[model samples]
Every structure is written in structure tokens, then in C-alpha cells.
Target chain A: MHPLAPVTAVGRSTLSMLAAIGRVTIFLGATLTHLVRPPFYPREFLSALLSIGWFSLPVVGLTTLFTGGALALQIYAGGARFNAEAVVPQIVAIGMVRELGPVLTGLMVAGRVAASIAAEVGTMKVTEQIDALVTLSTNPMKYLTVPRVLAATLALPLLAAVGNVIGILGGYLVGTTRLDFNAAVYLTNTVDFLEAADVVSGLVKAAVFGFIVALMGCYHGMNSGRGAQGVGRATTNAVVSSSILILASNYLLTEVFFSA
Target chain B: MIAMQDVHKAFGPKKVLRGVTLDVARGESLVIIGGSGTGKSVTIKCILGLVTPDTGLITLDGQDVRRAERDAFLARFGMLFQGGALFDSLSVWQNVAFRLLRGALKRPRAEAREIAIEKLRRVGLTPDVADLFPAELSGGMQKRVGLARAIAAEPEIIFFDEPTTGLDPIMAGVINDLIREIVVEMGATAITITHDMSSVRAIADKVAMLHDGVIQWTGPVARMDTSGDPFVEQFIHGRAEGPIEAVR
Candidate 1:
């Protein structure tokens, strides 16, 4: 048994971790560099906008719709204990707008969009389609990564805005129909409760989350190993990494936006 | 014309190319033959600058490729990847006309489609196949589509990687004939990588046998059988015993 074997293993893992971070940072830098450069592919960009935005609407809408309803019920029940049951509209509005709307949408997109981008691009890498693009005098980053990232960055905020409206509607429906509250009163309380800052902050977080999701997808995909299993791993890593980054960044952004 | 001098490439500890040197003259067709894992693909990729050599010089028309503007340098070359590598999302004509619809070679959409259909015809495909997706085509048809895409831009240098691999003998023969006819008609410099002797015989103006990370034998296709190099003889004859050891 070598005395420094444990130390060696730790050192090896640390170095590999650092190397992976270095690679991801470099890929992110290259993506940013290409974003500003010319030879843009508007066709690819338009197609990506459709994939990451329009197709993603239903899932984001549905997820937020349910969460808003559930949140109204939970806040009502918890407030009942404090003899403050009527705060349902205010709490639900604030919760949905400030956190649930953006975070839930980000997670759903991490599952749907990130996995999709990773699998598609990973398969392209495996099949040499990416190399084929290179041989055709096209830069893969400019043609591929830039479009999806830009689209997701733009689309997520739009989706989050839609989700906010639908989510507040969900809370309104539950408050009025199920909770024995007047519709006009619930709507008034909800509108009065939410500030411009709350909505803007979530949308801002959504944009950052969108960038993270697409970046992780493109990064894992472009660097995928050579086969089905490699692509599968890339897809999984894309979802996992983006989900974690979204949550982590949400906290950091929230702190920056609302900390005392 | 393409030239490689003392090319070397390594992925981690496994060295793929070690001091590989070869040349193809202007408008000549050269077929590189080697066993699997002999760096044949890597050698081709190096010439295309897809794989950068650790130590070597690759030149095109007496100019260093590394110094060439990337787009202008790549514009002169067309490639048929072994797996076809067609964009499945795109229909057949779109795949064939990919370059013609984008980048420096871009044409009007209608013009690109017309040219794509013409290239498809030249490769023995019907105009209807142009509207179909790559997945709808058979393997041989896919290969033909890939060939069509390769020549769509009218490149000065054309690379066919394993042109006859995984095809029926008749289909392989047809593809070989198309490639030979295309190369000669276009007067393009061609480099094909294949282990298939028939592809070599049909396509090579000159044959270079790559083995052990270097050129073991190279001469006119006429001199291949009598090259007197053990590696070349053992490879072309498909013998079990050879100077070049098999992986298995």
C-alpha cells in the first residue's frame, strides 16, 4: 500500500474537475465570440426559435398552472392556522411572480429543451454531421450553438411572462371558485400585491436560466464521446447541469435583486 | 495538388499517425489503402485540417494550409464522410445543396434546388429522391446522395472516405464508377481512403499503402501487385500471415 495513494486519487480527481471546468469555460467563451461575429445563419436561428420557444409553450404553461393552484391551497391552509386565511391571493401572487413562475419554467425547460438540444447535437457529433458542417465551410458554433442559445435566452423570458399570467389566473380561479372568495376581490388583491420588481426579477432570472440550459446542452453535446451511450450521457448531463445551474443562479440572482 | 510531410498525430498515449508522408498530384486520383486502425482516416482528416498534426507540414499548391484563410481553403475541398453525415432534418435536395443554400457558395433557393436535382441525376438518383429525407433512402442511395452533396460545390479537391464500405458488390461497383467518372470529368484532384482493393483498382491513378503509421508502398496502380513491399503484398492479397500484424 502506498502512503500517498489516497492523496494521489484526490489530486487526480481535482485536476480532472478543473480540466472539465476549463473546457466548459472555453466553450462558453467561443460561443460568445461567435455570437458577435458575422456569417450568421438566420435560417438555423429561426428554426431554433421555433423549437425552443413555440414548442415549449404548452409544458411551461401547464406546469405553472398546476403549481399556482397548489400554491394557493397551501398558503390558504397554512394561513388558516394563523387566522390569516384571506392572505391567499397576496401570497400566491407574490410566490408565483417572484419565484415559482421562473424557477418551474426553467426546470421544465431544462428537462425538455436541454435534453433535446444535447441529444440532437450529440448525435450530430457521433454521426460526423458536425465535421461535415466544418468541411462545408461552416462554423458549427456560429451555425448551431449561437442560434439555440440566443433563442432560448430570448424565449425563456417570453415563456416566463406567459407563465406568470397563466399562473396568476390559476390562483385566481382557485381563490374564487374553490376557496369561497369573490373573483373581483381576489383579482384586485393579486394585482395590488405584485410589484413591477417581482415580475422583472423573474424574467431576468429566466433569461439567465435559458442561457445556462442551452449552454450546457451545446457544451455536453459538442464534446460527446463516440456512440449511443456517449450521447445518452451527454443528454443526462445537460439536464442535470442546467437544472443545478438554474437553481444555483436563481439563489444568487435573488440575493442580488432582493437581499437586505 | 496535396502534400503531407512527416505528419504525426496522437490521441493521448495511442499514436495514430507517426511521420506519415504522401502526395497527390494535380488532377490525379490517389487511393490510400490500409487495414482498420492504420490511421487512414486520420491521415485524410489531417489533409483536410480536421485533425491537426502534432508535428508535420501539410501544403496545398505549395502554400501552408495553416496560413490559408479557413473559409477560402475549405471552399476548394469537398468531402464524402463514411457515414453519409447528411442532415436528416433536411430533405435530400437540401442536404445535397447545403453549401449552395448557405455560406459563400449560396445561390437562390430555386437555383440551389435545380443544381441539387441535377447532381442527383448525375449520381443516378431521380428528381423525386431530392424531395425525400435521407432516412427514407437505402444505404446505397444515402451514399449516392452524399456523393452528390460532395460534388455540388464543384470543389477543386474531392475526398471520398471509404467510398465502397458496407455496400453490396454491385452497388459498390456503381459508386466506384460514378466516383471515377466524376473525378475525371471534373478534372478534380481526388483522394479516396479504402481497404477495398476493387475500389483502389477502379479509382486509383496512383496507390499508396499506409501501414504502421507511414507509407509502406506507393506507386502507380499498375505497379501495385508487383510493388515488392511486404506490407503492400500482404494487405492487397488478404493473407492471414503478413509483415503488418492484424489487431485481432
Candidate 2:
């Protein structure tokens, strides 16, 4: 194959992907803009809070605990070679507060919350309930999308904070029992390593990830195609896109906060 | 009143509505008859702006519907979907009062619930059913709840897309009677799309047959027997042979 031929094909494919992304970005922005305007539905918002927030706590909490305990064991094993095992508690605290806590919680919630929202809304769209809402003079964006987005945005940060505490506690348990670290020393090291800025930054990341997850779910659902296959594809796309964006965004945010 | 002139809609290679045109005067019930996939529902969807026509003008009460504010234009019409499309999350009364509970029509919750219960009664449903969710109700009850919701706002126009599609004859007749009674009582213009001859006879003042992306024939329901169009004859009588070809 000619080098020019391959270059042209690559460019075309990249352009098409960019165009698709642009369309979704514009759709999400318009939906968010509609969210802050009038024609608000309080009942729908309450239902979403019950569905997305309250129902999501147990799963998110469990994910955080296991991840924290695993992180503590890994850090202790790695530091043992250099006799830097004393650093386990400090590193685990900083790690949970700054990175694993928010990002892991976000990924887990996105898998559960985002996929379900997308599937439910997509099925409703395919079945013409969205059209029925429009005919009933209810804006679909306001009635369906806004409440989910709002609930996720407000609820995820709180969930992230809870996950962070649970994860650190898990790390403490592992450190005290398995590694033979003094409980008092472990607690002091953890306290000394974690700063308010780190926790605040993680919460901020959680909020942003929440917005992305909900936005992706609603966008894919609204633009889903005609049948069951269409709904399945939308749900898959919502989860994949949300997870990828969360990880990519975590890196960018970490760089912004720590590098500068 | 609703009118469509030279409407056209296509999905890629297949043209669904090709220059389809018709009109429904105020208080008239027009039943559009057609074989499956012949665009009866598409025509109603076009008028409702759920599926925008590629070209043509749709007007309601002399106002250009396609160019008007969508929510306000839609506010004048009520639609009973093929499956009833009731919101599963809401109680029966809330579903009925969905419109009145929000936006400009927002009412006190108690007042809205009372109005919902009254509408349910109008549709032959009891007050006790008002607290049940859509999923908890039977198919006929769901249809009645959908009808109650449709008429709750007292819209000027109503569209019924296969309103009796999945019902047994008895239940279908009950829904047909309810629709006719509501239309006449409200004096609302009604457009119903169905292949059910019983429904056509019960609800329509005028009947139009859709075939091959166009209106094959249209006239008062009394003249349906002598429509003189082979497609209409074949469809109305449920015959396998005529000008209409049945796929093997």
C-alpha cells in the first residue's frame, strides 16, 4: 500500500470520529442548558435521587473497601525490599484520598448507574414514551435528563467522600493485622499524609465524573436507534464512554492539581 | 381542525408518506385505514411533529403547525399511543394529571389528584384505581387511564394510533365507545388510525384509506362499502385477493 493512501484513510477515519464526538458534545451541552431553565419537575428529581443515589451506596462502599485493603498490602510488599515499610500507611492514605477513592468510586457507579439509566431511557425512547412526553407538552430533556444529571452531580461527591473514609479504614485494618504496624503510628502517618487539598480535589473530580457519566447516559439514550438492539448498543456505549472519560479525566485533573 | 398539504417523508431508500394530504374538521372523527407499513401512523406522527415531514405544510386552526412553538402546538392535541405508553413510575392519578401538575398548568397536588380521579370516572374507572401504578393495572385499565390522561387537559384535537390494536373484541368495543363519547362530549377533532373495521364504524365520521404512500380513497364512513378503490375493498373486508398483493 502507498503511504499516502494509508495516511488519507487514517485522516478520514479520525475526522469522522471527531465529528461524532462533536455531535454528542453539542447534544449534552444543550441538555444541560435546558436543565437549569424552568419547566422543572420536582417529582422526577426525587425519583432519580432515590434511584441513582440512595440505591448506589452499598456497591460503591464495598468497591472502595476492597480496593483500599489491596492497596495497603501492595504498598507494604513493595516497600519491604528497601525497608521502607513504614511508608505504607502514608502512601495508602494519600493514594486513597487523592486518586483511587474518587476514580474507583466513579467507575463503579458509572457501570451501575450509567448503564441502567441509558438502558431505561433508551427503551422508553424506542417505545415512544419520549414522543408521548413531547405530545403531552413535557420537554423530554427537562422531564428525563435534567433530574438524573442533577441527582448524580449532587450525590456523587458525597458518595466519594464516604468511599475515601472507608477505603482508608480498610488500609488501616490490613496494615495493623498483616504488616505488624502499630495502630497509633499507622493512624498518625495517615493523618500526616492526607491534606484537605487532596480530599477537595478528589471530590471535585468526582463531581466532574458524575456529570460526564450522566451526560453520556442521557445523550446515548436520547439518540438511540429503533429497537432492542439499539437500546443495548446505547447502554454499552454509555458505560464504556463514561469509564474511559473518568480515567482520562482523572489523569488530567491529577496533573493539574499536582504538577502545578 | 388539522390539515396537511402535499406532505412527504422518507427513511433513506423507502418513502413512507409521498405527498399524502387530508383534513379533519373540528368535531369530526376521521379514521385512516391502511394495511400494515402503509404509513397511517406516520401521517399522524407528522401532524404531531414527532416525525417531521421532509416537505409540506401542516396547519392547525389556520396556524402553521410545523413553524409554531412545538410545546404550545402539541398542547392543543392529545394522543393515545398504540400501547397506551403510560409512565410506569407514576401513580394512576399522577399519570392522568401529568400535564396539570407541571409547567403553566401546575395545580395544588390535592386539586390535581381530585381532577385526575374525576377524569378516571369519566373514562369508567373507579376512584380506587387512581393510586395504582401503570404496571399494576391490566391492559384495559391502562388504556382507560391513557384515555383519561388524554382528555384531562381537554385538548382541542386528539390522535389515536391503533387505539384498539391489542385488545379483544369486547374490550376494543368498550374503548371505541369511550373514544366516541369523549370526542363528542368535548367536541374535539379526532384522528384515529386502525385496521379494525369495527373501530372505523364506531368512531369515524369520515374514512380515508392509505396505500402505496398516498390516500387511495377518502369519503364519509357511509360510503366505505362502495369506496370503488380495490385497495380499500381488500383492506376493509380483510380479503387476500384484489389489487393488493399479499406477500408469501
- Report RMSD for candidate 1: 1.0
Model 2, B68-99: lDDT tens per residue?
88777878889999888898778999999998
lDDT of model 2 at position A210: 88
lDDT of 2 by residue, A1-260 (tens): 78699889999999999998999878888876998798777878888888877888899889889888999999989998999888998898889888988898899989998899899899888878898898888889888899989888878898899999999998999999988989999999899878899989999999988888888899888878879999999999999999999999999999999995
Worst 10 residues of 2 chain A by lDDT: A35-44
In model 2, which regions exceed 4 Å deviation? A1-16
TM-score (all chains, Cα) for each model: 0.98, 0.96
Evaluated with lDDT, which candidate comes out highest? 1
Give the alpha carbon lDDT tens digit for every residue of B1-248 in model 1.
78999999999998888898988999999999999998999998988889889999999999999999999999999999998999988999999999999888999999999999999999999999989999999999999999999999999999999988999999999999999999999999999999999999999999998887889889999999988999989999999898877763
DockQ, every prediction: 0.91, 0.74
